[model samples]
Structure formats: C-alpha cells, structure tokens
Target: MRVVIALGGNALLRRGQLMSYENQLANIRTACDRLAPVAAEHELVIGHGNGPQVGLLALEGAAYTDVPAYPLDVLDAETQGMIGYLIELELGNRMPFDRPLATLLTMIEVDPRDPAFENPTKPIGPVYSQEDADQLAAEKNWVFKADGDQQRRVVPSPKPIQVFQLRQIRWLLEQGSIVICAGGGGIPTYYDEDHKLCGVEAVIDKDLASGLLAKEIGADLYVMATDADAAFVGWGTPEQKAIARAHPDTLMEQHRDEFAAGSMLPKVEAACQFARATGRRAGIGSLDGITDLVSGTGGTLISTEFDGVEYRD
Candidate 1:
C-alpha cells in the first residue's frame, strides 16, 4: 500500500517544550519507532510540520546583526534538511540495514498573486500569552492569532499549486526507499515576473500540501496525525465527543463551527478534500493510533460514504 503521513508539529517539538536538540531527538526517535512497522510493510512518503523548528530558527536569526534574517523559503529549506536528517537517521536505526532512505528537499510552487501574501493567517513559532503575543506583534509588526488560550505569530499560508521533483519521489519509492519530503509544506516558492523561480516569504499549510502530494503520488491512504486523539466538538466541555467516522460533507455540515481555524480546521478540511477528490479514506487521529488510522478506525475517518468498507490485506 502507498500511504502519505503528515506529522503534526508535536511530532517534532511538543507545545511549550524547550527546542533543544535533545528534546527534538527524543521526539523524532519515538516517531520513527511508530513509523518503522509501517515503513517495513508499505511504500511510505512522510511530510512533517516544522512550525516550531522554523520559528525557533527565526528567533535565533534575530539575535544576529551580521545579515538579514533568512527568508521564510530559505528557513523552510534549512528545516527540511534538519528535520529530514533526523527522521532518516532515526528511522534507519530501526529498520533493515540496507533499506533505502532518502530525504528530498521538496519545493512547491505557489501563485504569486495568492491572497495569503496580503493577509498572513498560518500560525508558526511557539505559543505565547495574549500579552506577549501582542507585545511581539507590536514590536515586530507581525500578525498574531489566538491559539486556544495562547497566541502565535501568523504568516501567509498559501495553498500548494505544484510539487516539484514528484517524479524523483516516485522513483525513490519504486526503489524501495523510505522518502521524507515536503517538510514545512515543501519550501514555498514561486515564479517571479522574470519567469525565474524564486522563494517567497510565506508558509504553506502542511496538511493541505500533504494531501496534494498524496493525490499527486496516487496514494491509497492519507493520514494526518495530531496531538489530539480525534476532532472533537465542544472540546474541553462536558459535551466534548469524538466523531468516529463521517463523510466529508457530513463533517462540514455538522462540525465546521467547532474546529479551530488555525489548528484542527485545516486538517479536517484537508482530509475531506483528499477523500472527496480521490474517493479514498483519510483519517485524523493521535499518532499512537497509526495502524488503526490506516485501517479506518481510531479516529475521525473521512470517505465517500459513512458506511464505506475499507479494503486491506
């Protein structure tokens, strides 16, 4: 089976955790442990979120006066390599010695006219108190959005238009290599007026980009692993509950208002888009339920029909 797994930010650096190599390494090792069985049995392409990683880099860059802070695109590329290297090493440690592994620095194309450039809405960096976020926003001229009780910096999160080097990714899978690409939504890039490719100061929604990649690669299944076990309604209240399964339209109709736009909304939206677009199943759940997710349980499952049966070997 071909599966595309999009890791949540927690997979790398959990919320409020220190962004230290030791912390990140511990997290990546656990992630690879969960992924080893899947990689052993299936053709896998992994896409991971780097919000915290990139945000931490941005903070580091600000401490220097030697050169302009690297653009978002450059930072995206740097994180891809940085995170992918950890995944490659850690995942390799658990699998066959000769099993192929490749970390491709994917570059996705975005429309130069994308409205996201004008209104930044994607949240990155660490979550902060409202006061801290507001102060940082005022000082840096950055946009801030409420993330639950906390706030985070928001940047333009444009949709991915094209995934470059897809053929190479496919080829690597064919060669039995475990591929990790499209970290931080494939390093957002665009075509300038001169018709030359250039990087942009924007971020792409990793779930959306991962869904697009799953479709482009003709994956049988797509999974968005999150810190939460399921997409819940009335979250944190007595009425909070998990939606075990629902058609994309059903989910939209019943629970659209319940999801957080910055957090769960885009993820559910992406899962719905992938299921509707490809007539396949997509799941959203905690990373612990990885196998159940692919098997059509342990999360909110999206499909053409609520009763559709999942076929597995």
Candidate 2:
C-alpha cells in the first residue's frame, strides 16, 4: 500500500513543552518507533509540521541579524531540511528493512492572488506570556494574538494549489524509497512575470498539502497523525463522542456547526477532500494508534462511498 502520513507539530513537541533539540528528537524517535512497522509493510511518504520550529528560527534571526529575517516561506524550507534530517536519521537507523530514505526540498504552488496573503491567521513559533508577547509585538512590529492565556506569533498560511515535486515523489515511491517531503505545506512559491519560481511570505497547512500530494500520487491511504487519539463529535461538550468513520458528505454534515476553524476543522476537511478526490480511504488518529488505525479499529476513517462509511454506534 502507498500511504502518505502527515505528522502534526504537537506530535513532535508536546503542548507546554520547551522546544529543545534533544526533546524534539526524543519525541520523533517515539513516533518513528510507531511508524517503522508501517514503513516495513508499505511504501511511505512522510510530511511533518514545522510551525514552532520555523517561528523560533525567525525570532532568532531577528535577534542576531542586522537585516530583516528571511520570509516565512524560506523559513519553511529550512525547517523541512532541519526536521527532515532528524526523522531521516532515526527512521533509517530503526527500519528493519534496508530501504532508501530521502527528503525532498519540496515547493508547493500557491495562487499569487491568494487572499490569505492579506490576512495572516496561522500561528507559529514559541508561545509567550502576554507581557513578553506584547513587548515583542512592539519591537518586531508583528501581529500578535492571544491563544488561551498565552500569546503566539501568527503568519499567513495560504492554501496549497499544487505540488511542484509530485513527479519526483512518484518516481521515488516507484523506486521503493521512503520519501520525506512537503514539510510545512512546502515552501510556498509562485511564478513571477518572467515565469521564474519565487518564494513568498506565507506558510501552507501541512495537512492540506499532504492531501494534495496524496491525490496527486494516487495514494491508497492518507494517515494524519495528531495528538488526539480520535476525532470527536460535539468536541469538548458533555455529549462528545469519538467518530470511527463517516463518509465525506456525512462528516461534512455532522461537523458543519461543530468543527472549530484553524484546529481539527482543516484536518477533517483535508481527509474528506482526499477521500472524495481519490475514491480511497483517509484516516485521522493518534501517532500511537497507527497499527489499530490501519486495521480499522482506531481513528476516524472516511470512505469513498457514503454508505460504506462507519460511524460510532
């Protein structure tokens, strides 16, 4: 089976935890331990979130460099390499089969006229206390928002239109290599008047990008590993329940009023999009539930056929 897995940012670094190299690697190793078995069983393409890491890099650059820091798209590319190296090293070492593992410096195409460019909504970087966040906002002239009690830096996260490296990815999969690509929804890029590809100052949702890649590559399964064990209906409410499976139309209807924007909403939407676009199965579940998720016992699964979709009884 060909599976494309989107690893969530919280899966790499837990909420309320310090972003340290050692801690991040340890978490990745744990995630790899769960994924190594699947890698042994099928062709795998890995995608990961880089919101916190890239934000941290941007802040550091601002502190040390005399010039303005590089744009978010460039920072996304850097984190793709940075986090990809860690995952590649660990996966290569732990894989039972001696398979080729590679990370592609991926670029995803976005519309130059994307409205997201004008409104930045995606949160990136480390969480800061209100006082510190306000201080940095004044010093850096950044748009800041309060997330719960803490504040975080926000950036433009444009929608992914296409995967520029889909051909290379398909070739690599055909070669039986474990490919790691499309980090941070790929470095957002667009064509200039002369038709040259140039980076933009935005990030793309990794789940959305992974969905595009899965559809492009004709993947059989799309697995999104998040912090939560299963997607819940009536989330955070007394009647909340876990959804095992639901057809694209069914899920859309059920979550019409319940899904929160910028949270599980996009993940659910991406899974539905991939399933509908490819007529295959897509899953959303926890990193540790990989085995069960594949076995149809865990996670929320979306099916091509509306009637075939399973839901909590």
Candidate 3:
C-alpha cells in the first residue's frame, strides 16, 4: 500500500536526551532499523517534525551576533536538510543498493491574513529566565510565553494551504524512490500584497501539514509515529483507556475534549481529517509499533470503516 509516515520529533531526539549529533544519529539509525523493512515492502513517503532541531539552530544563531539571525523559514529548511540527510543515509544503508531515495525541500503556502499571525502560540528556541525573556522581547520585539517556570520564544502557527512540491514528490514515488519531505511544515511561505512569494515568520503544525500531504498525494495509509503508543481517553487518570480503533467522527464526538490541546489533540484531529477526507486508514502510535501500525494490528487506527470507538485490552 502507499504509505506516508509522519515521524515525530521524539523519533529523532527523545525528550530529556541531550541534543547532540551522536544522539540524533544514533536515534535515526534506530528509527531506520524499524522503517527500512516498511520501505522494502511498500511505497513510502516520510515527513518529520523539527521543533527541537529548528529551535537549536535558532539558539545557535542567536549567539553569533555577527549578522541578523536567519528567519524561521530558513531554519526550517536547514533542519529538513540536516535531518533528512541523516535519515536518508541511515535508511539507505539497510535497503538494497538498487532502491533509490530522495529528500525534497518542500514549500507550503499559508494565508497571509491568517489569524494565527496575530496570535503567536507555537514555542521555539531554548527556555530562558523571566528576566532574559523580558530583555530579549524588549530588544527584538519578539514574543515570549511562560513555559513552566521558564520562558520560551513564541511564533505563529498557521494552517498549511498548499504544498508546492506535490508534483515532484509524486514523480519520485512513481520512480519507486523512498522520499522524505515536508519537514517542519514545509517552510511556511505566503504571497504578500505585492504578489511576491515570501517566507513568513511562522511555524506550521507538522501533523496537520502531513495530513494534508497524505490527502494530496492519494496515500492509502497515513500514520503519525509519535512518542505515545496510542491516543487515550482520560489520559493520565485512573480511568485512562487506550483506543484501538475508531471512526473519525464518532471518536471526536465522544472524546474531543479529552485530548491535550498541544499534543494528542492535533494528532487525533489530523488523523481524523485524513481518514474522513479519503476514507483511508490513519494511525497514531509509538514509532516502535510502525510495523503493526502498517498492518492495522497496532496503534490506534482511525477511519470511516470502523463502526465506532473500540478499546484495546
């Protein structure tokens, strides 16, 4: 089956792990250990998150003070190339030499008038002391929001409208190449009043963008491989329960308010959008469960085919 897998940022660098080349390389090797088999069996398109990677680049740029730091769109592309090369290298090592692979720097369009621009909620870069955050905000005219006891830089997260590289991606897949693109929501861009295409100072939700990619590419299956194994109802509580299968609309109606807005909610919503849009299966689960997820035996499968919500044992 044609499959599109959206690898969460955690798949490359888990939380609490030091962001180092060695660590990320090791993780990609591990992820490829799981993904190579899938690529061998089916047409595969990969999308990945770059929150931590992009933030790290921004932080490093901030320290230089030699020139104005590159914009978020540029940093997104950098992470795509940086992370894509690692994944492509590692995944290629396990596959047959004849199988080809390619990574594209995708561009996604967003509405210039999107309200998200007025409200910057997506956090990026390193956390800082309240004083430092305030100082930076004053000096740079940047926004900051409290992240626990510390503060973090915030950027607008607008919806992804169009993927500019769809034809290229489709052509690559037609050639039987394993493709990776749409990193960090495809380098957010939009046309200005002057009708000139310009990169926006924003981030796009990777899950949402990946869902759009899945739909536009006519994928039979779209899965978000996240840190969590499954989408749970009453997560973190004694009544918590794992959902094994669900009809997108039914699942939302029954437990829409249960998901955490910043995390599981987006994944669920994205999965539902794809499932409803195409009447195909979309899954959310841990990266380790990718094999079973493809087979519909693991992860929480969301689709119009299910009767309703079904729980796991």
Candidate 4:
C-alpha cells in the first residue's frame, strides 16, 4: 500500500529528555526499527515535525552576536536537512541497500492575508523570563506568550495553501524511494508584491500540511505517528476513553469539543480532512504501532467507512 506517515515531534524527542544528539539518535533508531517492517512491505512517504530541532537551532543562533539569527524559514530548512539526514541514515541502515531514500526540502505556499499572521499563536525557540521576553520582543519585534511560568517566542502558524514540491515528491515515490519531506510544514513561503516567491516568517501546521500531502499524492493510508497511542475522549479523567474508529463527520459532530486546540484537535482535523477528501482511512497513534496502524488494526482510524465513533476497552 502507498502510505504517508507524519511523525510527531514527540516521536523524535520525548518529553522531559535532554535534547542531545545521542537522545535524538536513540529515539530515531527506535522509530526506524518500527518503520523497517512497514518500509519492507509498502510504499512509504515520511513527514516529521521539526519544532524542537528548529527551536534549538534558533537558540544556538541567538547565542552568536556576530550575525542576526537565521530566520525561521531558514531554520526550518536546516532542520529538515538535519533531521532528514539522520532518518535517512538510520532507516537506510535497516533497509536493503537497493532501496533508495531521499529527503526533499518542501516549500508550501501560505496566504499572505491569513488571519494567523495577525495572531501569532505558534511558540518557537526557548523559554525566557518575563524580563528577557520583553527585551527580546522589543529588540527583534517578535511576539511572546506565556508557556507555563516561562515565556516563549510566538510566530504566526499559517495554513498551507499549496505544496510546491508535490510533483518532485511524487516522482521520487514512484521511483520506489522512501521520501522524507515537508518537515515543519514545508518552509512556509508566499508570493511577494512583485509576484516573486519568498519565505514567510511563519510556521505551517505540520499535520494539516501532511494531510494535504497525503491527499494530493493519493495515499491509501495516512497515519500520524505520535506520542499518543490513540485519540481519547474525556482525556486525563477517569472517564477518558480511546476511540477505536470513527467516521470523520461523526467524530467532529459527536466529540469535536473534547480535543485540545493545539494538540489532538489538529490531528483529528487533519485526519478528517484526508478521510473526507479521499474516502480512505487516516490514523493517529503511537509510532511503535505503525505496522498495525497500516493494517487498520491499531490507532484511531478515521474514515467514511466507519459507522460511527467506537471506544476501545
């Protein structure tokens, strides 16, 4: 089967773990081990989140006063190359030498007038004290928002309108290559006043962008491999329940308000969009269960084929 898997940030960097190269290597090795079986059996297209990686690069850049910190788009590309290289290296080691792997630096166009520009909600970079936040905000003309007791730099999260490298990605996939592209939502770009293309100072929602990728590429299954094993209702409470399967419309109508805005909601929304658009199944689950997810036996499968929402024990 042709599959497109979107790897969540947690899959690359676990919570509370030091963001060290060794830790990242360890995590990706695990991810590759799980992916090897799928790669052996199916056509795979991989997209991954690069929030933590990009943030780390931004922090490192800020440390050097010699040059202005690289823009978020540049950092986005860097992380795509950096992370993609690691994934290719690791995944390739596990696969047959004849099977090829390629990482494409994807560019996705966003509307310049997207309201997300007016409201910068996506946080990037390291946390800062209020005083430091204010100083940096003034110095860089950047926005800040509270993240727990600390603060973080906020950037507009624009919706991806067009994935510019779709043809290239498809060509690579057709050549039987495991292609990793669209990290951190394809280096958000747009046309300038002169109709010249340029990068934007924004982030694109990775899940949504990946969904678009899957739909455009005619994927049979699009699985979002994340930290969560499944999409749950009544999360964090005794009544919390895992959703085994759900029709996209039914999921939205029956349990839309249950998902958190910045977390599960996007995953569900992306899955629903792909399911509704392509009439195929989309999954959200832990990366470890990817093989089962592909077989439609694991994860929270969203599709028009499902009757309604069903809970797991």
lDDT of 3 at 270: 98
Off by over 4 Å in 2: 308-310
Counting clashing residue pairs in each candidate, in order, gives 0, 1, 0, 0
Provide C-alpha RMSD values for all models, in order.
2.8, 1.4, 1.6, 1.7
Tens-digit lDDT track of model 3 for 14-99:
76678899999999999999899899999999999887788899888888899999999999999989999998999999999999
Model 1 global lDDT (CA atoms, 0 to 1): 0.89
Candidate 1, position 45, lDDT = 93
List the candidate numbers ranked by lDDT, top first.
3, 4, 1, 2
TM-score of 4: 0.95
lDDT of 1 by residue, 1-313 (tens): 9999999999998878988999999999999988888888899999999898888888788668698788889889999999999999999999999998999999999997998888889888888988888888787787888787888888899999999989999999999999999998989988888999999998899999999999999999999998988778778897778878778887788789989888899999999999999998888898888887877758778888665322221
Backbone clashes counted, model 2: 1
**On a 0 to 100 scale, what is the lDDT of residue 1 in model 3?**
89
In candidate 3, the residue pairs with backbone N, CA or C atoms under 3 Å apart (3 or more residues apart, or in different chains) clash, namely: none
Which one wins on TM-score? 2
- Model 4 per-residue lDDT tens digits across residues 48-137: 988778888877887899998888899999989989999999999999999999999999999999999999977666678999999988
Report the Cα lDDT for residue 170, model 3.
97
Which scores higher on TM-score, 2 or 3? 2
* Number of the predicted model whose lDDT against the real structure is largest: 3
